[model samples]
Target: MTEEPPIAVLTDDTAYAEAVQLAVDSAAAYYADGTSTLDDDAYDRLARGIQAYEEAHPEAVLATSPTGKVAGGAVVGDVPHTVPMLSLDNVFGAEQLADWATSLERRLGRPVAAWSVEPKLDGLAISARYRHGRLTQLVTRGDGTAGEDVSHAIGTIVGLPARLAEPVTIELRGEVLMTTEQFEVACLKRQAHDGTTFANPRSAAAGTLRAQDRPYVCELTFFGYGALPYPDDASEQAASLRELPHSEIMTWVAAQGVQTTAATPVAGIVAETLVQVQERIEQIATVRPELPFNIDGIVIKCDLAADQSQAGFGSRAPRWAIAYKLPATEKITKLIGVEWNTGRTGIIAPRAVLEPVELDGSIVTYATLHNASDIARRGLMLGDSVTVYKAGDVIPRVEAPVVHLRTGDERPIEIPQVCPSCGDGIDSSQERWRCVRGRSCRAIASITYATGRDQLDIEGLATSRIEQMLDAGLISDFADLFYLTREQVLGLERMGETSTNNLLAAIERTKAQPLSRVFCALGVRGTGRSMSRRIARHFGSMDAIRAADAEAIQAVEGIGPEKAPVVVAELVELAPLIDKLVAAGVTMTEPGWRPPAVPGIDVDPDAQTAPEAGGTSELPLAGMSVVVTGSMSGALEALTRNQMNELIERAGGKSSSSVSKKTSLLVAGENAGSKRAKAESLDVRIVGPEEFADLVGALL
Candidate 1:
């Protein structure tokens, strides 16, 4: 790779200063033409680099380093920042942070009187100004001086108040974010409408905010942080600030009618404050209900202005504060059912009904089954069981199913020869099927699945809404989500304008998602999280998947002997349907991975590898054949074990009705009888209680 001189450094040293000036000039050229001189990443990198270089070389780098001053003469036309906004210099890990804390103490000549720590919302930074408590203007954090005026956008957002409690004039800055529920729903809506998708809430919100349309911005939500007009000026004293309680301010802001982010109480010292911040972040997934929006991390600020003043400012933000982020949420669940719902695409989808499960604190009950072929090839039957999981807390799925049990009831299921919706037989082709109902039954599963922790994961679209959406016939399928006018959504008995806009904005933001996300959104059968990855890997493009023959498809990994034919049949049935989705403008594409494929397939990589050549890779579960009698619904059943041992290499665990010395994890159901006793006498490991989860995760 060609190396560019460290622009951040070069901008400071020996005559390179002149070059930095030239680049600044070039930046101005782009800024003047309604274009950005730097992409977000590059700009952030350059600005930080320049700041670092200046901080290091005082003689070579001037006091007015790029880091210290506002953007000079960039000539941005849209919105000018009334107050300069600066980015904070980050310090990672607690030790280094402690060092900084110590330094602050040395500077202060005493311990901090008090400090306030708040969550640093991961999102775009913007400022909103209100005159006499009414909204005035909205601007981005451009170069800290000039910004793109988004006053038009400010006018549309749902939560911000038109007037404050005190009728106070002020300018406030904070992160504008799409709530986790909002982001998921938006992703679902986009996947249904245009096949396009975004990576996360931040990207979804940012893209929507910057999109050309005003209605789109109105849908995205915004939150606020500290800016001006302290309800109690006395709240600023260092001693008092340490006592600066978060709940009071939050309550105060609400009363003032100003939107405020949820924050915690202030502690006496930075160390203690940081500890509190860590705890909150750790519990974020657990506390989603209380949070207004999704948070990637938190920001800690010294509540006392005196300490803040003593600490002074960094290149941009105050040294008194910093941001602490959390890791993304992930977990596993199980698939118990796949509900087939007709769509705009005549092809049917098997949406998974899961065991009551908690992932990232949210109770999950459904996943998409992908397509019909997936259902059959995976040997999935009405009674056969399967595993479920999530990629990120945002995307839940049914990864695989067990094919061993002949529950007799677990029989092969198929799409009706005639369409379920219109009861009219429609034609299918190489890549898709035609929906007899076309758009009529398309929305059948919308209220449930669409809101089922997948697409447009509406928190409250419960049992009632499913019936309501169907009764209203306001929508036929997912695409109709975007078409929903505010008036129509608000017309629903429980929904109002605020709620409707929240859902609609989520719909708009999802359109910008990269294509692969759209494919996952489809809920294809036999397409586990990993397989979706494989398909994306081999095809590398949506066109390829849509065009490949069954023979060609069986060629991919995770695409097994039985599945290949099903996959081809799946796409064939989906082709016409997808075409309709395309006409609607969905952005379907390959997933994240696009690795070159070896001809042979590698199904079930997660299954334990054989213990060397062929030494009976002894299943620790060996001799522990299990008979899951009765209701094992709450626990892993015989089917669950059969599926799990394939995961256990040695457990070579078997399922039987009668338990012997070979019985392990007896897994007695509600009516389990003699078999349970036989197993207990045989000293079999009877797995039960809530401990089932621990045993399951450890063994698997």
Candidate 2:
């Protein structure tokens, strides 16, 4: 059997101390960004090694080591948590778990009778507070002290309640996650739209929850693990639930219409002894693969709250509970070669060509090496054996090379002298090399961006067909797409008569697309759908934008002076391409394009005589900041809070998630809770669903 090497090893005490803090800080930063730079498996292994070293040399342990607390930082700003959101310490195997139980019994001077075992969800931790049965504030667990307010995205999460079955004030602690099915669907959609796909369901969930736009596309879910009391209302429910067992608490929460993991067979099981708890953890690990969402481990907690209180806490984690982490799905493979590829942005990334090995139910042939700097840090060589694992159980990554397996025959990998894809000299100014040929080097990626839905809305122009056209020399650029002959397209493989006509018809329909879409399809630097819409509406026609100078272009909303030069340069570079597109009968002007005056920024001095502005007839809710609370009734009963916010935005107003003194109007619906009270306290104008309908109309 091949010896499994340690994930991380440090020789010097000073170096080890620095590594501990580095791991903590890096983990926190990555969590905040909704992405991971280090694999969890490697992180866990390194953490365990640090802990063992600390045990042997207690004086050498650094105060900033990640062992004693939750492994993240307060990067996302939000309100301070009333109760500290603690993290659970891990026990890797059954023996360690049993030892922890034994130690706990010794500390308490009694035999631990019962424990509750639940799956530890591999997802973003969130605290959702409901006031008077209405969901009010949703926040991420940032550094266990404070969190980012994500209440705006609450309605988009499935299995997360908008309102409770009974009127109560409670804080539900859970994991915001995405299921395997949802993740696959989201990846497909992202691939189609030319958006970045997440490494795993956890990253996907985190990104979706924090995303500012199109969060609904990622379909997130929440699984409740625990609950607490809202600061002011703690006496009411906290008193009544203080002595309840952990399993019973979850059951009660589930019964109150809050989704919980209680339905899982292994969860909520009362284990009478340390042996029983270990058995339950094993049972959970066995069924982990079949679970809808990913679970990293099993959490074993004291069943009774009274006992939990006596258990106390360490610097970070509670002593009453322990997490038994499942072994990581990993495999050892040979590093065969390195392949450098250029992206649409011209940045070159290195991929590790590996000897194929089966891992986590799939065949792994290659993994991402990140960049040349990363390569140097890992000290990777061509023929060295390396450990490979899925970073988040989704993305394949080269963890590190096994130094003991290295021989003199291993060759040192170096940065490429030229671009592999375009045969051009590499730009070495940055750590990551890029093709000096720029956008021209990645024509396929550029064309992919142009045909995306948010761009030209070209139907049936997916990546595969574009690659086929490109490989066959039928099209060189996006402008060439419009000039493709029917016979040329038919010459490509799998181009049936119906498919050919469909492609041709799709290409023809794009000519009449709105100028905003056309501008976006041109792939101008730093310009997206929203920016394109703003510019097109500001100028009314593409010709005016093309003829405008940097100063004039920067005058448009959102476009800054720094970006103005790039926008003008790109437009100038593509001026010939734009001419060809226009000559091909593509629409050059947006129909009925009007730049709406910004609220507060562009004040109309017409004596406030606008009809829809509580004066004259036109734009409804103009210059108003409206807050919608609770759930609406009648025709708009089914409309989600996000949808209602969208409706308010579309009607020329700002939609706020929280009520404040700045709020111009508060739309209070059924069971209006904390926000409504705040609105009333501030003397903000309050309106019913009917009144709100009168303002924005009942169109949605």
Candidate 3:
């Protein structure tokens, strides 16, 4: 398991004191009014720093320190709680979790019989009191021991019904949160109401839950974690419910018309062993990005009532429960500027230049802004504080601008009127801005992609060399590469005699590449190297492919109704380039692929075998839907992902990019993170790269 960066320790007394004050202030603002300058991760780090400093010098500890207290002892409420809504201690990794579990067993004088694991939703913790099955009051977990009444938000919350299924008096403790969809709607509503947006879902939920007298209302969701007898109720049913195991209590809570984790993908699961508990934690982490609501960690608690009683409670939390913290996926950062870059297809995309912020273990200095319209929609501006979100290997995106944190110095983003790559007119007709020159404006990029190892496999034609050639007017499109003479290549700045010879030789070799590689080099909008391979193999010849209409193209394995037309249009648009390549003596037919039989044509049986003739069935990986992830090693180390997809197809397997129930196998190599976990959760067969290499050794 990969470990996250450790929290910074405050060695200086002055720095420690300042950190403590900052944490206290932030906590006070957050608990009092659901607003804070710092995000959860930033505050956690500051609190941990203060705690580390205090551990070394207890005498210097501030009285208002956030450590060892719920809500950091910053909030006071008029309404007192019958049972404290305590915070859970957190474990950053498996080792800490194991140590905590061992300590719990030691305290209990026995191994726990069962453990319940559930997502620790990133939301405001609250207790909802019901009398005779009717919701009476909603209280925020303001200092744990006491809370503020938020009954005004009772009717606006989903999953917490006004009346229960049965007439029972109970106090249900759970989290109040806004789902991703709800958060978006709330942001729109807030923007409409006052032109300000909440930073993230958690803060949005917090503000929405406590807000009153607003013209618009934002709905929130509740998920019950614990159920207990109401302070005024002495019913036998309520008493028995309190004595039941935590898992059963949650089930009972759900049965009584209150929502629990039962409906979500990361539902509360009962595990008998620590290993099982960790597995469940991994499973939840794998699906965390896909969950509608945000969860900061997984909560593991001893399931049995006896275990809970024996372990008892600590100063701030239960001894039997701990939160297995996942790495934070969001951070607030300053949008320094925006960069407009042209893609191969001439889509001018806007990228956010950010103040360096560590997110999900990476230093993210840049995030996707999407397009000009998205920038306007998000109301993003230079010098604005923006909430950047990232999950797993997905690219970071600027979710929204932190409107409240903006200064008057911030300026509106400048949308480019001309192509950034070339001084051409801009096509602002679609949501995505494009260069009027289209692919021609980004010729160098497209040519470089064409010479990539999986495409034309042209060696010695690095991006620098391609750019030099382009600037020298020796090549415009990739098709011009074959036309370059030895003298023409030698005219470039860095082209020595031997280097020129190698460059020319590399370009000459590309002329003999099969139709698949040549098609991949075309860089069609909807087709990648794998899709190009499928198209080339299905048609066998370039003429057959170009002659095929969109309906005919859809017969290929992965080509669909939407994508088929795009492929056809791209091919038609590239006709001049294709003719140039044909004229340059490039191979136009796939090496091993057999084209479909033509109707009413007398064919030579020995000339070419038809696809229906059982050629693929003999291959080792026939009929398999394979997904490859992470870095490969040994014999497969030199291969790019496109080459790997080529090998999978060569061995008669369909290569897929994502893992799902349909994924027949996963070739998970070193450091295969979420995909590997997801595959395990789905019970998909997995093999290491070396093992996979052996299976496809002949093809390799």
Candidate 4:
């Protein structure tokens, strides 16, 4: 696919005609075949250019131009709509959104009473008609005035029930789309039937909705956005619904067993002022990346029926509503090559090297392919144009190849026959290929992780120095570092007398680290810093952990049956290294760890009694779930995330990675983003890092 052209002002008739043609063609392909060369962002720019040209030269506008038509005048149907399925005008940023709000108030001749904000779901728009509380037909939004019949897809769509809770005739307007999980399932089913992979979720939903008589089926999801009285129905209830506010109408829709935006993070909400609406928009945008579905923009509509009626409608859209668009997260880029890099666990992961493309707000040059199987599933090839997606803080990934735009010059991706790091044979027993050498193949990665701040925390052991030691044969594994001599360190390059002594001292300190850090430094497959701490505390000693079987290991707080076996096997494999560390005088037991009480064991009367179930504990933050976000300051300025977690544990609180309803408190520092917004939305208590520092000051 070609890169999107820059948006330009149409200064002459030639430029104007070209822009109009591009817009019409792109829209036609999108509506008719569920595929388009231009993405939503590019198409919107082209359409905006056409609108600007027509505004400046109204007398010279052509009759066939796509200025004031739904679906860009590219789609037609025989089924007429009761009310025009109008499209929404777009605003790019806060200033434009504010200007639109001001214009709406100006047109209404008064300040608006209220506003409703919702997510603008990226999907196809359809009208579902219900007769006497039963779904009878589904129609696509073709040219707004009329639409194509798609009622044949009734049973396959989720959220659009065949029977309603009430026996009333009405028309429901909503978007039909596939969620992230649903889209993946659909792709696998389509590929099983020898169909080409879908370019994106929006197109997959579009194709699945219109499909007929296929041997397989792909599920679709729906969320109602509007409700109106059926053209043929003259019921009193229908008339009364039209008089109600937009927010109340949506609530009624949800009560009738129809799915609305009530369950989503960006649920429809009523705001009494423009400031509240803007804040809601910002909140939605902040959590956009974490949502399970795709949303291109936030829709802001006047809530009061009286306000909507007074504002009236334009030729294309209602003046009462506008869409505030966000920057596009998906962009077309060329797959230049593939690079296979072995992970710390010896799994060979494939990464896609792409032509630099601007996605979201940054330039992306690489994307994750997950593994060799993922590349095969996507049918990706070198030199092919691919859709790369990047959200906030999410690693960029290759969605799929644009098969329609592929040329014969594209070549098949080559899978590596040997391990990239160790030049050894690959074990292909599982879907993800691994090296026969296992952790031995990735010595550098494993060693570096073992010495990280959250693990053993051996100071002055940077990756470069570790590599130098390995090159000189002074260290074969992390356990060997504790046995190095001063003469051996001084033999390496840049190792002066004082530097050697400091490095030796750092290595000496690691010998006294508790068993929890030592086990964490072992680089077990199924265990991380947190799990390592849990395991060491539960078993109390490394010998007991190694002696425990899979069944006994399952008793650890987070370990399950499947994971328990994996941890047991990894510990067995690392037995030799563990014995070496023990001989080197490393601490074998966790500090302050105690064995759990047995059911019938005799206990010492002098020992401290356990806290009662409903009683408060002595710890300041006992039983609380705490989340820390953003940058810390003041007394907590220098604490790392792992150190913060340690502090939370010391204060008897459970450190959580995310903020949800279960979260008791959030430590929000400067520039906190999505987690802070979610905490506020869920009504979870929030405080600054300084306050958090004070709360846990005793433990510190």
- Highest TM-score scorer: 4
TM-score against native, each model: 0.41, 0.49, 0.84, 0.93
Q: By lDDT, highest first, what's the ranking?
A: 3, 4, 2, 1
* Candidate 4 lDDT by residue in tens digits, 45-135: 7878888788899887887787777663578778988899989888888778888999888888889898999999999999999988999
Tell me the lDDT of model 4 at 421. 89
lDDT of 3: 0.87
Model 3 TM-score, 2 decimals: 0.84
Q: Can you write out model 3's per-residue Cα lDDT over 396-454, one digit (the tens) per residue? A: 99988877677799998998888888979998987878898888988888998898888
**Candidate 2 weakest ten by summed lDDT:** 607-616
- Give the number of the best model, judged by lDDT: 3
lDDT measured at residue 166 in model 1 versus the true structure, 0 to 100: 67
Instruction: Give residue 673's error in model 4 in angstroms.
Output: 3.4
Which is the better candidate, 1 or 2, if ranked by lDDT? 2
The residue ranges of model 4 lying beyond 4 angstroms of the native Cα positions read 1-15, 56-62, 231-233, 537-539, 548-565, 602-618
**TM-score comparison, 3 vs 4, better candidate:** 4
Evaluated at residue 291, the lDDT of candidate 1 is 52
Q: Model 2: how far is 278 from its true place, Å?
A: 2.2
RMSD of each: 25.2, 17.7, 4.3, 3.4
